[model samples]
Structure formats: structure tokens, C-alpha cells
Target: MSKTVGAEGWTVVHQARQKHYDDRYYGQFLGTRKDGRWIVGRMWSGRSMDDGFHDGGWDWSKRFAEPSSTDAADAALKSYVEMSHETFVWNRVFEQRVGEAIDAYWAGPEVPGAPRLSAGWCRTPDGLPGGSTVGLPFHEAKYRLLQYLRSTESTARADLSPRTFNLHDAVELIRQANGPFRFQHGYNAYWLADDAS
Candidate 1:
């Protein structure tokens, strides 16, 4: 009866939250067929065990929320596409895109040929870019964002692993941080963008 949201009626929802993602990625997406109906209760799409998966008992469950309006349904669908887009990517490299293209960005010595992040990338008053043509990796974006947040808001920095994400995730973070992903090192230090963004 519905063709809007990412998951439709009688669907399953799965969320696995852990201290780290380096483990076997064991998780489960349970569905129920009871009371003369198959109710989709849980869903997952990641590396798991041959037998199945678990969320340390706390990494699972289900819920149902009916949108009151068509606009609300469309918004929910947009959120679904943003979250599950990885399942439809064309390649591993494509999976890691931050903005534009990964190659349009670089983390090494440039030869005046690549299209790096520049003034045009950031427009928000809080996201002013530096006067350079350097781009950054996801982790570096994390590092720099932390610095900016702590500096501007007196917020305590969390102990986050910088290399725990792909380029696209990092770019999103940098943009959220109001634009502070510019490289402060010399041109020879382009390689540091990933570890330092």
C-alpha cells in the first residue's frame, strides 16, 4: 500500500552500535511470522558470522511510526536513501566519495592538474576556506573539526579514531563543522590531509 519510505510496511529495522567496527561485524536481522502474519522486525546488511549475529544483546529491536503527511513520508525516504546508499555503490572507490570525486581531491603532491577543495567549497560564514587548493580525507576532517569545535565552543574533544571512515563521511563532517578542513602544512604535506583533515 506504500511505495515511499526506504522500508515499507511490515518491515524490519536493525541498528548495531558497538565500541568499534573492526570485529567480525556479527549482527542479525530477525523477522517474525506469527499470528498468521510475517512481520519484518529487524534488518542488517554487513559482515556477520556464518551462524548469525548479535549486538551484545543491546544492538537490536523494532518499531513502527506512521507518517501523518506525504511530505513526512518523502522526508523519511530521503533519510533512507542517505543511509543505505552504500548498498548500491558501483565500486569500492566510489563508495568512499566525499564531494565531487575522490580523485578531484588528493592527499599528496599536486602537479597543478587535480581539482582540489578550494574557496568555492565552503560558503557559510562559519565555513570559510583558506586561500589554497588542497582537499582532505575523512579522518583529517575529524581531527580538524574537533579542533574547531573545541576552539569555538569550549567543548571537550572526544577520543575518536580519525581513520575509521571513508572520504565522503569526512567531507560531510567538515561541512557540518562550518568549514575548517583546510590544510595548514606546506604543499609537500598534502599526504597529511587524511590523517589530519
Candidate 2:
């Protein structure tokens, strides 16, 4: 049933189809029972049509209960909708944070004594090597670096074979590395480009 509140307070408003007595269904003047008893009936929301009895036939002996105050209903609806909107906002914020962390790690100054390869190895100015056959030894440093790269490009290509460095293998290597910048399951493939950096 539907309820509406006027300027004063809650009141049973009668529509064309049925009269709503505070969430309880009330029959319209027409099609009511032969007896003078006011039968409660169900009606479709926003429609002027009675949906018949609620399981059994209508009952009028029960006292009508007042619907929630209009202010309370409005507040509840507003809170529910706002909560749903906030969930989406938080999800986007989380994704952005992940993206920011990945970007910072990539652009940050190189680690001291980190494995240094020629510019021909990786195309990025970071001087990391990039190749199809460069089987990076299953090591921690390599794992962290791969995780950072994979955050930006999920399907980055690598030359390492499934035997040498499949996706799972690379992820495990990164886990073993266990560095502050490491991720759990990120590395997908190696970057296959001329090391122009």
C-alpha cells in the first residue's frame, strides 16, 4: 500500500482505485463487500486498480495502523540512495589509489644497486631490459619490477616461455620478493619491444 502526508501529518488518502489507511488496504466505494464492513484490499502502486484479497478475503475487524511519517520515509529513502552512490564513489577511489601506486613505483628513481640493463633491454627510460628471450631469473627484484609494469599493461608480452616464466610463475616470484611495492597476482606477460630507452 502507499502512504502520503499533507502539511499537517499522516492521513489516509483515498485514490481512485482504493483507499490507503496508513499502509493498510481499504476498499473503494465501488466493488466493496455487501456488508458495511470496510475490507482492506491490495492495489498496485501508482495504478488505480485493486489487486484483490491479500491471500484470504479482506478483513475489517483489525484496527488501521499508521504508516511511517512522511519525513521518516523521505529520510530513509534518501539515506539508502546516498549509501548506494557512496559505494560506487569508494570503489572508484580504490581503483585510483591502486593506479597511483603503480604509477609512482614506475616513475620513482631507480633502486640503488638494482639490476641495471642497457637501454636496449627495456624501451622505458628506466633502463630496464625488454626482450622476448630474456629469461629473467625467478628472482625478487625482477618480480617487483614486473608487477609495476603489469599494473599499467595487463597483457604486456614477455619472451619467457611457459616453462621458464608463465603468469603464475611470475606472480609467485613476485610474492617471494615480498617487497613494499610488490603485488600478489599481477605479472601477465613480458614487454616485447626494442630497448629504445
Candidate 3:
């Protein structure tokens, strides 16, 4: 059987959740009986030994119910597909646009005692680039987003005080904060732009 779709006399029509580390499947299964009855099984593979026996170190279980009619089976499967589509949309929004924005936000360096510009990339009066781009701990986008959410927000501003003004430090600061902020994409960006209008 195909991991994503059906094949070889049966198909995994709709999956409620991905297979667990224990190698158990959770989803809807579709097949045709020799008598032409449509079998739409509620699959909860590896739930228990009674539901299914363990084989080759993998838990396997499924309980099928025949639909009253082909029309009913088709409708039920269609509903599952619709629900899956809705989840796909939200996942895309969170993982793509929101993820990209957050990465862009943290891509900037936030070193202490650095100088910064008013709008564009941070640059020194001598016209040299500033700051270092450090990599986050995890290589995944989701973990980066989590780090961003858990990080403490700093109110440090470029116009702070009459402290010593170093051009090189200012340039470094601007380079550190040169990317789009976390709220600059996804629905947050959209709403912000709408409000600006």
C-alpha cells in the first residue's frame, strides 16, 4: 500500500494523524469486497493486541464497516477529504508565511552595544557593514519559531540616550536588525497593511 494513497486492492483514503513512532497507523481505509460491497474501515492500527496482533515489531489493527451504499461511502470519504484540506491550509499558513517571517526576524544579529540606522540596513558612518549572522540551535523552521516565541522582547532603541555614539557600532546594529519582523507576514502583515490603508 502507498504511504499517502491507495494501491494493491486497498487505499489509505484519509489519515487522521501520521503514523506514530511505534509504527501504528491511524486513518480511514477503503477497499472493495468480492461481493461488490464498499468497505470503509475505521483504522486504529496497533491499538491493542486484541484489535490486531503484533507482527514484525509493528502494531497492526483495523475494524471495517460496510457502508449502506456506494453513495454513502463516497460521501463519507469526501467529507474526510474536505476536513483534511482545511487542516492543510492552516498548516501551510503557519509553516510557510509565518515561518518565513520569523526566520527573517531572527536572521538579524542582536549583539549588545551595537550601533544602528533609522530604517535601512545598519551601517557605520564610514560606510562599512556591521554585525554577525549567527545560526540558531535547531536547523528546523518550527524550532526556530518556538525559540522566537520564547525569547524575551527587548525595548532597546537606537535613539536611547546621550551615551557615546560610535559609528561602527551603529552600523553593526543596523545590520543585525535588517530583515522583516515576525509580524510582517501571514495574517498579521495582512491586517497591519489593511489598517494602514
Predictions: Cα RMSD each: 16.0, 23.8, 19.5
TM-scores across all candidates?
0.19, 0.24, 0.21
Ranking by TM-score: 2, 3, 1
Q: Model 2, poorest ten-residue lDDT window?
A: 29-38
lDDT of 3 by residue, 53-97 (tens): 122122232223443333433343444344434323224343333
Q: If the candidates were sorted by their lDDT against the true structure, best first, what order would they fall in?
A: 2, 3, 1
Q: What overall lDDT goes with each candidate model?
A: 0.29, 0.31, 0.31
Q: Candidate 2, residue 170: CA error in Å?
A: 0.8
* Candidate 1 wrongly placed segments (more than 4 Å): 1-10, 13-69, 85-197
In model 1, the Cα lDDT at residue 193 comes to 35
